[model samples]
Target chain A: MSKNLVEFNNISKFFGSVIALKDVTMHIKKGQIMCLLGDNGAGKSTLIKTLSGVHKPTRGEIIVEGKKTIFDSPRDALDLGIATVYQDLALVSLMSVTRNFFMGREPMKGFGPFKTFDVEKANNIASERMGQIGIDVRDPSQAVGTMSGGERQCLAISRAIYFGAKVLILDEPTSALGVHQASVVLKYIVKAATSGLGVILITHNVHHAYPVGNSFTILNRGKSMGTFEKKDLSREKLLGMMAGGEELDKLEVELKEIDRTLKN
Target chain B: MSVKSKSIQNKSKDERLRKVSRLKVLLNRPELGALGGSILVFIFFGIVAGDTGMFSAYGTINFLEVSANLGIIAVAAALLMIGGEFDLSVGSMIGFAGICIAIPAIYWGWPLWCSILFAFSMAVLVGYTNGILVVRTGLPSFIVTLAMLFILRGATLALTRLITGRTQVPGLRVLIENDPIAWIFSADAFKGLFSWLGSLGIIALRQDGTPLATGVPASVLWWIGMTIFATWLLMKTRYGNWIFASGGDKLGARNVGVPVGRVKISLFIGTAVAATIYACVQVLDAGSADTMRGFLKELEAIVAAVVGGCLLTGGYGSAIGAAFGALIFGTVSMGIYYTDVDTDWFKVFLGGMMLIAVIFNNYIRRRVTENK
Candidate 1:
């Protein structure tokens, strides 16, 4: 069995009077993809934020590599080899690809006050790394805003991998993409997992998750339904649970009656 | 065998895709519209005032002198705008710093060097206040700096009157006439070159039969030097990256571990210091300081930056472009006097040029994005 890269043990988060996440536990193993499924307001964002160090859990601990750890900031989490690619991708649209790739941690050459950005090294690495993820960026100088949504996601993911992230959390990476673009991003997620990195993909789309997810954790209203291995849950059963099973069935019957009355 | 040929074909395709045309690369530059606009303005003014010595060597220097005075502040303002902040107090800082220097040296019997240092420290203090207020209070920089503008202007007026019992302080010439620092900061540069040109009848001469050897003003040299340094800073340094990122998306930059607050504070301080430099030059050259000095200059600086291709939205601009924008301003302001047009109509021309430049910039940005 692969080692668990990170484990969230009975984590709970509260905001003033509201509970964002409650007694949720999950683990991601190295070389595995964990799909976090939840609808709107299901506390999925809060859970990922805690894991990515944007928020500290109110009750519980995060174990990383067999040691209890607390992350004070996103930088702290990043230093621990955990990176999050938020939906916005944290990219400056007006900046060039190379500039965006090395925005905060730019390579510098020279000594003392004379130090300068190593543009040549940045451009070459940006282009090469992007090509590795099946994006052949023609020019590293191209502005990031000019790229397609799928390409931007690929760029963000590849950047996280290049920076030595052991566990990557992608927040709805494909929610804004078209059908073809979503497939392209799914391919990249699988590629990232194949490279021995743990990945947490957050989305409500079971169709998308069922294909690449090795394990799935479904959350509804701040509580976990269950964590299931890929072999244990079929697509139909997962969809039923996601749509609130009986509630959906009742809505379907009411919709049919309305349609018959309109026809008459 | 089929696989091998397919791999070769893919490599060729990638190579072809990477080859962009030179024209396309040039057009994609942020300063492309500014560059084109500057050239067009120069030609238009040159034709209208051609015979009136507006194109002559001496006339060129005259207009450049005007531009250089404004260019120093415009360049700094461009950087601040790129960092997504405004310093409306820049014009007021000029007036205040000049008073700080003059009242101490000319009225209080302080040494010239000591007076200059006092003025710079005051500038730093004001700059710090502006930066801290905006960052800590979460107030818009426009409102913060707007308050600073009035505060500094009123302070300059009140202080000058209280110290000297007048609005103007004179006698700076006696204090700085023999000073070496004055020669470096306030003297005319390249005097020998201009004098030699005048001797050969290439440049104009004074009525006393001597060459008009006040060649390029020292401020122009400083403008050029500062412009080069600013361009290098924006294009080559890691700090430049911070500036761009901070302006582009503050939240995104913070998420990526960029210190957005520190970057903004540093930019504010830089704009104030630039204004102080401009004040020093003006006071030393005129040999006097007035409370009304640098009135409405901040608006001109912002206009120059906008004409230079800086988006009012921030995150995109070039220092070199701002310098050219200053040049266009100086030419039109001086060129109208040489032509038969009404001098009062200069403001109309200025407004028209600014509008045209902004439209051109927008069109270029859209075209570049579409082309990609």
Candidate 2:
């Protein structure tokens, strides 16, 4: 009975004869973690582009909160409370942490036609937001580029949460992270979900998602493999499906045969 | 239960604050140290000029006035640079705007305000053209604005000759002497206002009933006020953030739903408007507009921004720094005048200083960011 915050109803996308996404129907519930798994060229990027309003689907509609809406630009999607965090978060490396967090919506003080930057409030708010996300980053005045990759990702996520994003779309957030670092990012994803925001996690790593995801959608060559509830699928099945089980098995057998002949 | 929860929450908040302070320490790690060349120049100027009356209030005011003119242009130029573009035509635009005012005020007999308005509109139009061509056609701003620079310079020369029959456009005496507009363009407003306020000082209020007045030059006051405003815009406003983002990562800014095109256009307009404002002041002070005035001054403005700590690639600069950079240039120029040093040798010093500062800035960035 939970209403969908956003839904792609049979959307298709194509570049020349190559289909990027084919009749993909998927929905993100208001308060749940939805993971999209795929290898390279599995149309995951295409799907994200469509959802984040980077591109309009070649066919079908995007339904949001029981009403279908057409998003012409990313701002339109953002207005609907959908924030997309890319692999490389858009942050000025040299700018202070508070500046990066409040990039588009900075607070100003003072009266009349001449207003001043509310430095105290901005610094305080940035610090508070970072604390909420369990990032004990020292002064909000610190430069963003000084933070590690994982920490920057956390900052980006926290920024979205602070900006009142109803739905959070993460693009390969953990791809560049080490095991421990990825675990840190995964914790934040869970935290975001628990805070009552719909999280759409885009990643190729099934292991990273297995523990956190409530539902899964696998894509292959621009088409949806299926959408599965976490209880309905096993870890092995998901991996096998992603690696193309039969083909990987045949390749493994052939490699073994060659090794045995060489030994003989 | 409520009391316990509240105490626990307070404890957690305190813990969080401690952790955040630690992170702040990590982030404040210096990317670059203080600029060496700027310091050296200041020392050289001080040592050479300080021996005489060069360090006097009159000399200081003269230097500050020069800086004010340059700083005003440099601030907007820095904004454009931070937005990832450059305008080489700003200097020529200054000449053109002055000519616009001169022609209307003298020949057409228009009111001073009307002429000033016309000049400003012309500058805005030129800025719009630069923005449109650069953004719409996807041309490199360097090339487009460079072309604009030459075009405007040539046009200014030809027009001045055609209208005035000389290289200089004449007839701004009326505004300078009588018009109220002169107060804004030439008079030492900053000094006057501050003297008035300083005279009313409660701290200086003595039983003797004599209030001391502090004379702050109009140019210095203007520069300081503008610096404050520019700092606020860059640090606090949404538009200011857009400028930084667009300059830092134009594609990234666009990806994040920033109106990159609009931001660039506005900055272009701002730069031109600043030029026009400076032009009006310069013409009022001189009572004539020279076609060759401000030749290569655009480069100086850019140099000021770069020396002030703006990354040449875009993003990362402070308006205060740019103003400081202008101060360095202004002082060097006037300092040379006060000293026995020939003005011709000044260019060599300026060039060497610029080169050294760039190297130092780069080294600092590398040192701070490498480990991080």
Candidate 3:
């Protein structure tokens, strides 16, 4: 039996002459948090897109549950239990919590063509799942717009889990959240990982990633800085490396020179 | 993952979901404003023009006929608005579809039933084209359907003139005399029930032992049936959820695997089909089809939808609400003829009602989405 839930082996993607990802290898295992840390335009989005079946790699192969997979479309990826929750693309604010929880895949009742959406069953499941994650929903029928940003994030996450998501790819789930809400989401992330689901938390915030991450994969200009186990990496070292240590060193010197000119 | 037990127990695990109160549910309904407005209009007319036979069975049916004709279109418009689009071509489509039904059946000696089917098929084609254009070009439905409005209207006028040497096509009455399905669009339903009530004196009747209002208009029945069907689709079907999601956030809905494009396109077809039904009812009832029929009806449908609590920005509405909105419009417009008020004041009433309804809708939305 394979220990890894997903494996991206030497994957490279390009659009015309523009290389978005190059020689990137990453893996997610059962019950593990794999954080993908990168600056803006560091090929993080492209990598997530490739993994979620939005884009196929021009080179290399993707393996899911040790089986070689060809992601011809997003549906193919979803069928393989790969769910991606993009920031601001998770919930419809104008809809009820239950409706947003079961947007595309709705539970039906009755027989033949006289079928109906089972609102009672959906509300039960939605509220129960949300409650399991420590969010006591005030009302299952409440509009998602009335929920806090963190709770809405939880709803999206738990919804994915309920729908049989084996591997979760979250794109900057906490980037737009407040401190308290971000902490709430981080706690849920750990809870999700402990449930034996592989999670790939994508963000540039080292602080947000370091505490929850079991392993780190830093992306710099479409290239990998290699993966590191949490035990072997310190918070300070990870932060410096993620910010491009050598680039920051050169940038600090130029900033000091500008300060000297200002003093004159 | 014992998240509830193992997590630092700051929050209580015994917390249960709050029970939704009946009053809150009523207040939260999108149709509340329209429902209230309908009652107010009905009562006002009853008090002001009670002696004028405005509330008589016959007169009530008169205004209901007016309301039903508009309600059929308004309900479909509300769905499209909730799905985040508009069909400005609806009024023109009504006219075009009328000609499509009448010209063939009257001039070409085609069966009335075949002409009805032909008109509906043409509507589906136009709707498909409208949906395809909006989806492929990524243009605002307002602009796209606005162009459709002009093109359809011009085509109806030009084609009618070219074929008949005039802008009107008459003689549909003779064609429907022997048709099987034409009665479905006539004021011919509930004849037994209406006559029984007339005999019992529950309903006023004229000479010859016949009820003045012979039967419930098929238009009213169609309006109610379509409204109920739309409500069920919005609240009890997977496609209903898709409509809400597509209107609320297209990109977000698409990301979560909702077929947003298909939802929008289907909604366009729905509006076109509703317009064809409107045309069929009008042509059969009037015994004629004119290029000028249904002029500005598209805007009236939209106004009714908005008054029914549909958001202009999309994502929230109710079909029943739209029905009530049409009811109010029909009552006020028709009730004016029975009273001393000038008919011209109806336009002012319309604009005023629209602004007030929008304000009420805005308030309700804010109240529902309030921060805890």
User: Which candidate number would show the highest TM-score if scored against the true structure?
Assistant: 3
For candidate 3, state the interface root-mean-square deviation in angstroms to 1 decimal. 2.1
Q: Interface RMSD (Å), each candidate? A: 1.7, 3.2, 2.1
lDDT of 1 by residue, A65-143 (tens): 9999999999999999999999999998888899899988899999999999998788778877988777877667778
Q: What C-alpha lDDT, on a 0 to 100 scale, does residue A262 get in candidate 1?
A: 100
**Worst lDDT window (10 residues) for model 3 chain A?**
A133-142
- Per-residue lDDT value at B99 in model 1: 95
Single out the weakest 10-residue window by summed lDDT for candidate 1 chain B. B4-13
Model 2 score (lDDT): 0.80
> Looking at candidate 1, what is the lDDT of residue B242?
89
Give the alpha-carbon lDDT of every model. 0.87, 0.80, 0.91
Query: Where in model 1 is the C-alpha error above 4 Å?
Result: A243-246, A253-264, B1-12, B15-20, B178-180, B207-209
Give fnat for candidate 3.
0.70
How do all models score by TM-score? Answer: 0.93, 0.87, 0.95
- For candidate 1, the docking band is medium
Tens digits of per-residue lDDT for model 1 on B1-372? 456434434543574474566898887777776678778878888788778888777788889988998999999999989999999999999999999999989878888888888888988888889988988898999999999999999999998898889999998998887665666568887788877888888878999756664678888998898899989989999989989898888878877788888988988888888898899899999999999998988889988888888888788888998998898888888888898899999888889888987887787666655546
Q: Write the per-residue lDDT of candidate 3 for residues A1-264, one digit (tens) a residue.
A: 248899999999999999999999999999999999999899999999999998999998999998999998777888999999988856888799999999999999999898999987887788778878888766677889888889888999999889999999999999989999999999999998998999999999999999999999999999999999999999999988875776898999999999999999
